[model samples]
Target: MNEHVPDPAAKLEERAKRKAAKREVKKTEIAASTLDALKQLGYANTTLRDIAAQSGMSLGSLTYYFTDKVELITYCVRLYKAEFIDRIEKSVTSAEGRDAVIDAFADELTRSMTEDLPTHRLWYDIRSQAMFDPAFRPVVEEIEGKLLETLTRVVQAAGQQDTSAVPLGYAMIDGVFRFLLQSRDRHARDNDELMAIFTAILRRIF
Candidate 1:
C-alpha cells in the first residue's frame, strides 16, 4: 500500500506566485493612471493629488508607490526607454542594407510624431525643462546615450564604421523629431520634405 502526500514545495511556490501576480496588477494600475495624468496635465503642472484622484487611489497610496513627482517622471522615462530603441531598430532593419535606411527612419519618426501628439507635447515639455533643471539632466542623458548606441549599431550593420559622423547622424534625427513635434500646431509641414532632408544627410554620413 502507498500513501499520498501533499507537496509542501509546490504549495509554497503557488502562494508566492499569487502574491507576485497581485503586486503586478497593483503596479500596472498605478503606472497606467500615472501616465494618463502626465499626458493630461504634463510634468510641472501635474501633482500627486491629481494622480491619486485620477487613479481612484488615495494620496497615501500614490506616495507609497512613488516617493514624489520626480520618481513618477523617472518611471515614465524608464517605461518609454525601450520604445525609443525599438522604433529606431525597426526603422533600420526594415530598410535592409540596400534600401534608404534614412528614409525608413524618417517614416518611423513621422509615424510617432504625427500620430502621437500628446507624447509629442510631453517630450517638448521635458525638453524645455532640460535646459534649466539640473535634476533632469541624467534622465535626458540616459535617453541620449541609448539613442546613440542604437544608431551606432545601425551604422555598423549598414557597413559604416566612422564614429565621427555619429554626432551628425544624431543631429539629423533630433532636427526631424523636433520639427514634427514643434511645428504642426502652428504650421503645416510636409512629411515628404522631411524625408528628403533625412535621406540626403544620412547618405553622406553613412
Candidate 2:
C-alpha cells in the first residue's frame, strides 16, 4: 500500500476558500445586525461608526469588511430586498388561482407594511436619494426591476395573457404602498382599503 500525501497547493487553496467563506459569513452577520439601525437612522444620518456600534464591532473592524456607509448600506439593502422578493415569490407560488394569487400578494404587502414599516421607509429614503446621487441608482433600479418582475409574474400566474397592463398594475401597487407608508392611521381599515384596491387592479389586469 502506498502512503497518501496531501498536495501543498491544494491545502493552500482549501485554506483560502475557507477564509473567503468565513469572511462572507461575517459580512452577512454584520449586515443583519446593522439593518435595524440603518432603517431607524436613514442612509443620510448613518455612518460606518454607527453601523459598527450597531454590530458591536469597532469602526476599524467594520471598515475591514466594508469601506464606507454607502457600501455597507448597499449590501444590506440588497440582502433585505432579495429576501423580500423571495417571500413574495413563495407566497405567489403557493396560491392556486388568480384570485388567490391576488389575495396572497395583497396580504403579504399589508403584512410587510404593517410589521416592517421602518424598513420600508428606509427603502423609500434610499430610492429618493437615488434621484440626486448616481451611486444609489444602480441598486435602486435593480431592486425596482426585480419588484416589477415579481408583479409581472403575479399577473401572468393570474392568467392574464395581455401583459401590457402589468407596468400600470405595478405602478398602482407601488403608489398605494407609498401612500399607505406615509399615512398616520395604519389601522385595519387601511389594510382593507388596500386589499380592495389590489383586487380591483388584479381584476382589471386580467
Candidate 3:
C-alpha cells in the first residue's frame, strides 16, 4: 500500500489558517499592551514605541499591523467595545424584571470598574480625543451607539415609559464612570458605592 500525501491546496489552506490564527493572537496582545500603556502613560504620552515595548514586538512588526498610533488606538477601542458588549449581553440576559435589569447593569459596571479600571480609563481617554479628532469619531460614535442600544434595552426592560430616558440613563452612568476615572480619592470608588449610585440613577430614570 502506498502512503497518502497531503494535497498542495490543503497544505496551503492549513498554513493560511495557522497564519491567520497567529495574527489574531498578536492583535489581541497588541490591544492589551495598548490599553496598559494608555493606563500608565496616558493617551497623549503613549507612543507606538511604548506599545511595541509593552507588546514585546519590534516597532517594525507593530507598524506592519497597525500602521500608526491612530489606527492602533482605533483597533483597541473596537476590541474593548466588543468585550464590553459581550459582558453586557451576559449581564442582562437572565434579568427577570426592571429591578433585576438595574441590578445587572450595576453589577456589570461595578465589575468593570473594579476589575479593569485601566481599560475604562483608556476608553475615556480615547473618547475625549474623539471629540476633536475626525479620524476617531466614527468608531467612537459606533461604540457609543451600541452602548446606548444596550442601555435602552435595560431601561425598557426595567419598565421605563419614556423613550428619552434611555439616553438620560446612559448619561447618568457615563457621568459617574467618568467621575470615578478622575476621582482623587481612589478608595471611595468602591463597587458598593458604584452599585448604589447606579441603582438610584436607574430607578430615577425608569
Candidate 4:
C-alpha cells in the first residue's frame, strides 16, 4: 500500500474556497440587515453605522465586508430585486391561460404592494436617487430592463402579436402601483380596483 500525500496547492485552493464561501455568507447576512434598515429609513437616511447597529456587528467588521453605504445598498437591492423578478416570472409563467396570466400578474403586484410595501418603497427611493445621482442609474436601468422583458412576455402570452405596447403597459402598471402605494387603505377594495385596471390594460393591449 502506498501512503497518500496531500498536495499543498490543492490544500491552499480548498482553503481559499472555504474562505470565499464564508465571506459570501457574511455578506448576505449584512445585506439582509442593511435591507431592513433601508426599508425603514430609506436610502437618504441610512448609513453604514446604522447598518452595523442593525446587524449587531461591529462597524469594523461591517466595513471589512462592504466599503461604504453605496456598495452595501447596491448589494442588498440587487439581491432583493433579483428575487422579486424571479417571483413575478414564476407567477406569470405558471398561469394556465391568458386571463389567468393577467390575473396572476396583477395579483402578484397587489401582494407585493400591500405585503412588501417597505421593500417597494425602498426601491422607489433608490430609483428616485438615480435621477439625481449618476452612480445609481446603471442598476436602475438594469432592473427596468428585466421588468420590461417580463411585461413583454406577459403581453405575448395574452395573444398580442404586436409588442409595441409593452412599454405603455409597463408604464401603466408602474404608475398604478406607485399611486396605490400612497393610499393609507390597503384593503381588498384597493386590490379589486387595481386588479380591474390591470386586467383591463392587459386586455386592451392584446
Maximum-TM-score candidate: 2
40-79 per-residue lDDT for model 3 (tens digits): 9989999999999998989999998888999999999899
Runs of candidate 4 with Cα error greater than 4 angstroms are 1-8, 185-189
Question: After aligning candidate 4 to the native by TM-score, how far in Å is the CA of 178 from where it should be?
Answer: 1.1
lDDT of 1 at 120: 58
lDDT of 1 by residue, 1-206 (tens): 77988799999999999998987678667877877888888888999899899899999988887788877776666566667679779777856663467667666766666666676577667767888987777887888788898888878767776777887888887776687567777876677765666666667667
In model 2, where do residues sit more than 4 Å from their true spots?
A: 185-190
lDDT of each: 0.75, 0.83, 0.84, 0.82
Q: Which scores better on lDDT, 1 or 3?
A: 3
Model 2 error, position 155 (Å): 1.5
Give stretches of model 3 more than 4 Å off: 1-18, 159-164, 184-187
* TM-score, one value per model: 0.79, 0.90, 0.86, 0.88
**In terms of TM-score, how similar is model 1 to the real structure?**
0.79
Ranking by TM-score, best first?
Answer: 2, 4, 3, 1
Candidate 4 structure lDDT: 0.82
All candidates: CA RMSD in angstroms?
3.2, 2.0, 2.9, 2.4
Between which residue pairs do clashes occur in model 3? Answer: 98-158
Minimum summed lDDT over a 10-residue window in model 2 is located at 183-192
Give the C-alpha miss distance for residue 140 in model 4, angstroms.
0.7
Candidate 3 has a TM-score of 0.86
